[model samples]
Target chain A: MQKHRGIRSTGIPENILGYLMVAPALLCILLIAIYPVFRTFSLSLTDMKMQFPNMAKYIGLDNYISLLQNDRFWSATYNTLFFTVVSVALELVIGFVMALIMNMPFKGRGLVRAAVLVPWAVPTTISATMWKFMYHDQFGVINDILFRMGFIDQYQSWLGSTSSALWCAIIADVWKTAPFMGLLLLAGLQTIPAELYEAATVDGASKVKQFFRVTLPLVMPTMLVALIFRTLDAFRVFDLIFVLTGGGPGNSTETLSMYAYTTLFRNLNFGMGSAIAVLIFIFIFLISLVYIHLLSRQND
Target chain B: MHKSRWSNIIFYVGVVIFIAIIVFPFYWLIITSFKPPEQLWDIPPTWWPSRFYLGSYIAAFTERPFLTYLKNSIIVATSTTAFAVFVTSFAGYALARLHFKGKNAILALALSVSMFPGIAIVSPLFLMMKEWNLLNSYIGLILTYTTITIPLSMWNLTTFFRTIPADLEEAAKVDGASPFYTFIRIILPLAAPGIFTTAILVFIAAWNEFLFALTFNTEDALRTVPVGIAMFPGQYTLPWGDISAASVVVVLPLIIMVLLFQQRIVSGLTAGAVKG
Candidate 1:
């Protein structure tokens, strides 16, 4: 008990010491993460082309106005939203099934778990590239397999056509990320006690009913959290699209992040690029707000 | 009994199919790495390479400065892990054990920062790096990586530090040990497993990061593995062989790490999600 007094009587006050301890990390976040976001917001207000930095000037809401009228921006937004909704929906379903399978008492579960980590462990660029090769129009295994199975009469260019390119990218994304979602849901599933399931079974509930009644309700919070995480991640899809199709067959698969990269780096349109970047930040910020609200509700 | 048998068959079949879907791409990657160019372009791709032709692996290293990319990735990832772990340990300790004002605010800040879309901050970070003349340097990427890695590391370490009893710290305090001193000498060693877990996760993240690495370091010599493999010249013909080989080289170490530290990684990842 006297030892507690010793801690209090130390030279530096605990609050100040705490602040000092956290200063470096806080500074890093503010400078590298928080400040840059504000900088991008301000940059979005100016007509700052990277090529001619000297001609930069404040052009209040013109960039945003133009972005609203620009068909490309709308298309990119549509593409991003579509990708997010489709891929996240697929990931959630596939990942939920994976979780259910993983939660079952099975032999060689460790090996299955490790195997599931393969896609998640691979870098996004690498996985995208791998899938790109597999979707190669002429020499692709996917085309070969589909043809052999009599699914298609001719080998189709999966990534070379606009109609199918985005879907192809979504498939690749679901493949890469479903494992991660599975892992998160598996953690959630593990926390559910076996007693509840046993109790449900004893009450003459079928397996399917037990899942809907016992499993789903308890895991709802975790699923919601995982859903938002994947939604936000899917919304920011960049590396996969970058390497897989370079947001092409046209701008068909161009995500907001990819569009921002092209504008900022390739086209060197700093202001427009920043505008796009700011929109992405806003979208992600809103998604995060929903997450926080959900989390708070769960806590209550 | 009949119903149980039917369910058992379905369960095993589901497990097998799921595992196959998950493992097929990796198997494809490994096989492609060893395939000769002739076999790679076969009408129907060969499921198995006829021979272990090591040409692609050799070419991947020799054709481009891949060794440099590998070196850069190692330097950036290791430096980021070291810097992030050092910075976050103190913050975690403070948040976990200390009685302080605005602790919740800081925690909330960290949580939100973890979810920040990198595309938003990238442009300004690029300009800042340019202004500081760090665009092509390891320091620029390392600093940026530390920023992104800090929040999770803080959360994870704080969760870990909370599990450790305060009685040990009190005893150390009574023996005239300074808080900082007790932290470095006593607390850190005690939290080594948590710290190591955080380090592995952070290292994997830094290793696999693409957007920042791609944006900041455009110089050929400065590229990391992800960017290097991605930006491989395919002007005439895409070098599938070399690219696959390079992918294998980079992915092998990560696979090994995940295998060795599977349980630790799971717990570390879910620490924030499950408990928060």
Candidate 2:
């Protein structure tokens, strides 16, 4: 039935009738997605700030040049990459393992499967706070557990130190985000037919061999698809870092989104904000292009 | 084969530990919410509350107009979701089913628009909202959220709508129903899962939304859950216990909804990921 459903979408006719059918939504997407982005590009060229919008000057890529020379932009760029690369890579590995575990036949698996999603379901801000509390210097759950185990005599201020805070933020992110990766990969795992694995088993291929030869190849595409999604989201993350550390302890956890936001809102420097916005957009667009290429192959 | 059975046990145990780690923060919140103010900050860290105290929620209710904020969030979220789904379905149906002159181009344009960072236009949108006098109003938040939500909802729902058989629509039309009625009666009902998925996805997105809610709404009366929680800690700082309890209160519903309808929600999320 599903196979038949896929092959026969060709019969629907195009009509002004069909166009009228969907105009409201098309217009909304147009105005929201396309128009504002273009406006942002235009706004990037101007010397606009909060004080006076009407008397803005068009300086033509000077903002971009100034952003290139700024130490803060480079720092944010490095931090964003560190966050994205480490988190997405870890998520992919952890998520794949969890996906494999959940696919196995077991008792009370339903309950366990549902429970794993709780972290993913928790709003990122709340989860950050949850972990923030857990990581507190004196009274945190993490400190309690570590203290009980005699890991250290003195309490650690996880969010206070410059060297450790960003990594701590990454840990909070990984804890909340890995479940999401696991779920996406698990769905991918379900799509691979069982018969191939059975045939491999009958041939006396070792379980690891069967997995490498069959599962890994089949799941890579899906993992690639999932990776693109997580990376983009991680790159744009603001609320979690904002609430957890406020990009604090000497700017250790600042990402492009927070920097752009602080520039626009805190300093009211629209020009610098728009320049950072363009840079982030360019980086995302380049990666998205790679994903789009992968997608094109998948569709074909 | 029997040798690896031990490995299977190892895998299950490992998975259990992982899931436990995943769930503990939220579990902590629940326990914290019902604990008394005095015991909220236990030194040795009490694993469970001896008794459930309902007063934290009461204070959460009484300390501020909790119900009013909840109502405002619902109205804004519901309206945005409704407008978004209604608009996206028609637009998605059109893009998917109709042979528009710019069908492929339209889809490409939609995808491209998503490239711009939300912060870039935020200033402009902020200015635009102020110019139009929508700051602090539900209408303002709704419009701002709608811009993001509509694109988001449409992108995912369109993928689902495109999968439906068009012959069903054609048959409904052949029975003398206008295309509008046919869409309303035939296509929409069959697309219930997609619609509901859209609703759940939109609700969570709206409920979790923060920047606009915080920056756009100045009055205490207009805050939503995210903003509510952001301000929650400050308001009850003197009583650290109540603040933790209230943080739990703010997030509890979202956690519950996502856990209960987890399968649907995950699928909706991946549809966004997989397609976009």
**DockQ, each predicted model:** 0.66, 0.46
- Per-candidate Cα lDDT values, in order, are 0.91, 0.77
Candidate 1 DockQ, CA atoms: 0.66
Q: Could you estimate the TM-score for every candidate?
A: 0.97, 0.91
User: Which residue pairs collide in model 1, if any?
Assistant: none
Error (Å) of candidate 1 at residue A254 is: 0.6
Which regions of candidate 2 are displaced past 4 Å?
A: A1-14, A294-300, B1-5, B114-116, B235-239, B271-276
Residue A102's lDDT within candidate 1 is: 85
**lDDT string, candidate 1, B1-276, tens digits:** 999999899989988998887777778888999998899998878899999989999998998789999999999999999999999999999999888899999989998898899999988899899999999999999999999999989999999999998999998877777787788879999999999999988998999999999999999999999999899857999888888998899888888988998888888877766765
Candidate 2 local lDDT, B20-119, one digit each (tens): 8877787777777787877766786777887999888788778866667778888998998887777788877777665658777766666666554576
Model number with the top lDDT: 1
Docking class of 2: acceptable
